[model samples]
Target: MSQIRLYDTTLRDGTQAEDISFLVADKVRIAEMLDDLGIHYIEGGWPGSNPKDIAFFKEIRNISLKQAKIAAFGSTRRARVKPEDDDNIRTLIQAEPDTITIFGKSWDFHVREALRISLEQNLELINDSLVYLKQHVGEVIYDAEHFFDGYKANPAYALQTLKAAADADVDCIVLCDTNGGSLPFEIADIIDDVRKHISTPLGIHAHNDSECAVANSLTAVEHGAVHVQGTINGFGERCGNANLCSIAPALTLKMNRPCMTEDQLRQLRIASRTVYELANLVPNKHQPYVGNSAFAHKGGVHVSAIQRHPETYEHIRPEKVGNLTRVLVSDLSGRSNILAKAEQFNIDLDSKDPVTQEILETIKNLENQGFQFEGAEASFELMMRRALGTLRHFFSVLGFRVIDTKRHGDDNPLSEATIQVKVGGKIEHTAAEGRGPVNALDHALRKALEKFYPQLKQMKLLDYKVRVLPAGRGTASITRVLIESGDKNSRWGTVGVSDNIIDASYQALIDAIQYKLVQDYAADKKE
Candidate 1:
């Protein structure tokens, strides 16, 4: 089997995305993560462009990487300047990365319009830049910027650019679909033609403008390209770059190309999520291979089929990518969905038990009344435990009141919540102020219960979302509240529904607290 080199450009090209900007420390952490994922090259940002990237290259030298070589990215030397005289080239060498990757104009139009340089001048820039960098850096890579579009417009000139890099004896020549508009067939044909003129090893850098980045990348590998460049989760400028999260698994499991070991492949999901979390961005649940819903089954028929054979609906096992098959419960759920979920929760539930039917009926009815359990599995689990008569009451809510007052001159409203709760034989009343009614209620509830169960202090409400159901019009519509809560160990979701938004929020809040107490109680018993 042929080995494919995986080059990750998340620190450099990925930050060009509008939604992504990493601190110097964030870049180092992600580079370490990429090294752990068995990537061959990690492209640190351009040292000449930003101070943050320069700091990153300096800080990263302190940490020991296992196998991945850090590559610094920049453009070729300026048109009229010598390679040794260019500030960009000087800074790249000072960064002291193991490898240096510099891009030059491949398209004749860009040569004339973008760079305002003669065609031959651009060739000299590419050749001289690599020759100079090769003396300072251990290895050098040449990125043929806009190579696909350049090849399509002027194939002769595009091949000449690769020839210049080859003449410099650069380590590799990467053809870039910079505009990201090239099709897979076009990439295959262009690469096939380029191989006739250039004997250098080839790599691919693709963007997702036309949604063909992943397909084009794989097609390049199929056509004999040995190196692949992409960002995690396809994050980049405009439409983004090819997603290594999807590409790595495809190369390993589907194409018989081994870019990483099986154990490293299992960290694909973790790597994808870690980048998203560090960037303070939400993970795309529908993203391929590493997404939350990649192997999720919701329909009754699909769940039933997957229960017998998962391959019926799934292309590959989720565990291969560090993700697991998830059975979501909803109005469309069948006995198989319930049984699958019961097994997931480690609940001993019999398929034929009357309680099973009762839980199924309750789910369907509640869903009809503006409740969604797919995002609130903690609430679903609590409901199941209640039906089995195994759930312990942590605390009971006696009453709660929220007051929102807006002064005539003040723009901000003052919200206060007073709540009373009884824990066994003791009753506690508390009042708290917050930015909103829900916040005040949450504070008051915690104040009332933290004395009884101090472990509740560790739990935090992470996210809160409210959706208005179509059951009624405008202000009369029913609302559903989904609350995401987490401690240091794990996170879970709970939901509630009611006509009044505050009442619905209260229901979800109560479930969130009860779920945490139950988890603590179970942990204590196990200990």
Candidate 2:
């Protein structure tokens, strides 16, 4: 099988996504994980674009990478300036990377309109910039800006642009679908034409404006693309860039080519989630292979068929990409789903028993109460485990109170929360102040428990979301809160519901802390 080079731009273009940005520390963490995943090329950042990216390159040098070469990205040398004197070129060289990628216009329209340069001069720029980059780096890749559109407009000139990079001895000529509107067949035809025109190794870089980035990229690979450039999670400008999460698996498993090895395939989901988490964005629940719902079954017939033959509905096993399969219980669930879900909770469910009827009725009631078991599987599992007597809840709250006050000049209000609780024949009292009344409640709850469970220190609330049901909008209100918490090795999600928003927040907070303690206690006993 061929080993197509996989180039990841999750740190560069991926961070540019609107309302999504990464800290330098998070970028380093992602880069190290990608290196461990065996990606051939990781475009760390455009060191010349911003100070944060530059700092990332500096800090990454201290870490040891096993198999990935970090590439510094930049545009070609500035017009009417020598490559040696150009700041962009100098920054790329100063980054001290093994490979440098530069993009220059190949479309005549862009040359005339965007760059305001003659077509022949644009050709010289493409060749000269690549030739100059080759002198400073072991590998130089020339990205033919708008190569697909250029091919449709001036096929001869576009072919000449590739030839220029070839004569200049660029290691790879990556045909970019810059505007990202080309169809798959069109991309395939362009790839075939470009491959026939140049003897040099070919690469493909696709964007997602047409929502066909993955298809177009794979089509290019089917034709003759030996290298693929994409950002993890499809993050980039506008619609986004080609997603490496989908592409890597397609090449390695579907196409029978080894863009990444089997081990790398295992880390694909982890890499995708890491990027999403660092960008402070909620992960797409249906993002191809790595999403939470990728292999989930909710309907009666689908779940039953999946139980008989997973291949009937599942293209690939969820566990293959570091994710778990879910047998979702909804209004459409049948006895098979109930049994499967019960078995997952270590319960032997008998459809003939009244208890089974009771469980299904409870699910129906909770679903009516706006409890979505599909996204809140943890809550469902907890219910199933409780019904089966497998769950051992640590303790229950006897009472709690908050003394919160607002100051005139201070922006933050003065808040203090105290918890009075009795657990296992012992009473524990604790007081703590927090950023807000809700925060004060959380801090005091955790503080009281920390005395008994030291494992609470490792549990950090990664995310919190709240919603007020429209039906309960009057004096009485029903609120729901979801808490997603993480530790060193595991991430768990829990949900809470109550009439009072404070009560709902407290419920989730309790679950968040207890879940961590349970996991740590379980791990210790196993050891």
Candidate 3:
């Protein structure tokens, strides 16, 4: 089988995305993660661009990488400057990376319009920079920026650019769709034409402007390119770059090419989520392979089909990408869907059981009332337990009160909450203050429950989300709150809905605490 190299530019190109910035530590962490994923090249950053990147290079030198070669990214020498005299080239050498990737203008339009340099000078810069880097670096990869658009406009000049890099003995010539506007057919044809002119190993770096970055990269590989350049989760400037998370599996499982080992491929989901976590961005749950909803089935027909033969609905096993198949319960679900869900929960429920039909009706009714259980599996499970007459009593809420007061000249209002709860036949009353009414209520409730169940300290609210359901009554619309709660070992989401926001938040919070106690109760029974 042919081997295609996975080159990750998350630390460099991926960070160019708006609202996506990483600290020096985050950069090093992601680099190590990429190496563990068995990537061929990990572009650390553009060392000469900023102090943060330079610090990254300095810091990364101390850590040892196993599989990937650390690369420093830069541009060709400036107009009319010798390669040896350019500060950018000199700084790249100082970084002392295993590979040096320098991008040179491949389009005649960019040479004249962007760089304001004659075509001949641009070619000399490309040749001189690659040759100079090759002398100091173990391997040098030349990035032909905007090569596809350039070729479409002036084929001769584009070919001339690749020829210059090939003559310089660069290890590989990477064709870049910088604008990301090229179609898959154009990429395939252009790569074929470039191969006819030069014998150099070819690579692809595509953007997602036209939403074809992954398609373009695959097309290039199908044609002749052996190296794929992309970012995790497709993050980059504008629309983003080609997503290696998508590209890796396609090359390995579908195309019969080896990009990473099976073991490394299994780590793709964790690595993808880690990058999004470090960037403080929400993971895209609907992403191609590794997303939470990737192999999830909601419709009755799809669920029944998948239960019989997963291949009927899924292209690949979810476990292959570190994700698992999910059978979501909704109004559209059928008896088969209920049975499948029951099987996942280890509950014994037959398809013909009256409770199964009752649960289905309940789900449809609750959904009509603005209660979505799709993302709140804990609440759904709790409902099942109650319907099955297996729910254990943890605590019972007696009453609760919240007060918000604003003093003269104080812009912020002080929120205070008092709660009374009965835990194991004893009533506990507690009060607390917080920045907001919801926080105050949470503090007060947890305070009342802590003395009875000390394990409450181990659990805390991770996230709280609120949504207003559409209603003709406008401001009187019902509100729904989803609370994400976590203990040290795991996290679960619970939801509640009410006309009052505070009431909705309180309901969700109660569910969260009850869920934790139920887990403790189960653990105790197991012991």
Clashes of each: 0, 0, 0
Residue-level lDDT of model 1, residues 211-309, one tens digit each, is 999999999999999999999999999999999999999999999998999999999999999999999998999999999999999998999999899
Q: For model 2, what is the alpha-carbon lDDT of residue 308? A: 88
Per-residue lDDT of model 3, residues 334-415, tens digit only: 8888888888877899888899988888888988888987788888888887888888888899999999998867579999
lDDT of 2 by residue, 1-527 (tens): 35699898888877777887888999889889999888899898899989998998899899999989999999987778888889999999899887898888888888899989888888787778888888778999888889999989999988998898899998888999988899999998778777777999999899999999999889988998888999989999899999989998888778888777777788888888888878878899999999988888888799889888889999987777777778989877877788888888556878797777777888888778866666566677677767767677687788899887876866667989999766687889888998877789988888887777777888888878888777846857678888888889977777788887778788777777766766676788889
Instruction: Score every model by TM-score.
Output: 0.99, 0.90, 0.98
Model 3 residue-pair collision total:
0
* Residue 174 Cα positional deviation in candidate 3, in Å, after optimal superposition: 0.2
Give the winner by lDDT.
1
lDDT of each: 0.94, 0.84, 0.92
TM-score of candidate 1 on Cα atoms, chains taken together: 0.99
Query: What RMSD value applies to candidate 3?
Result: 1.1
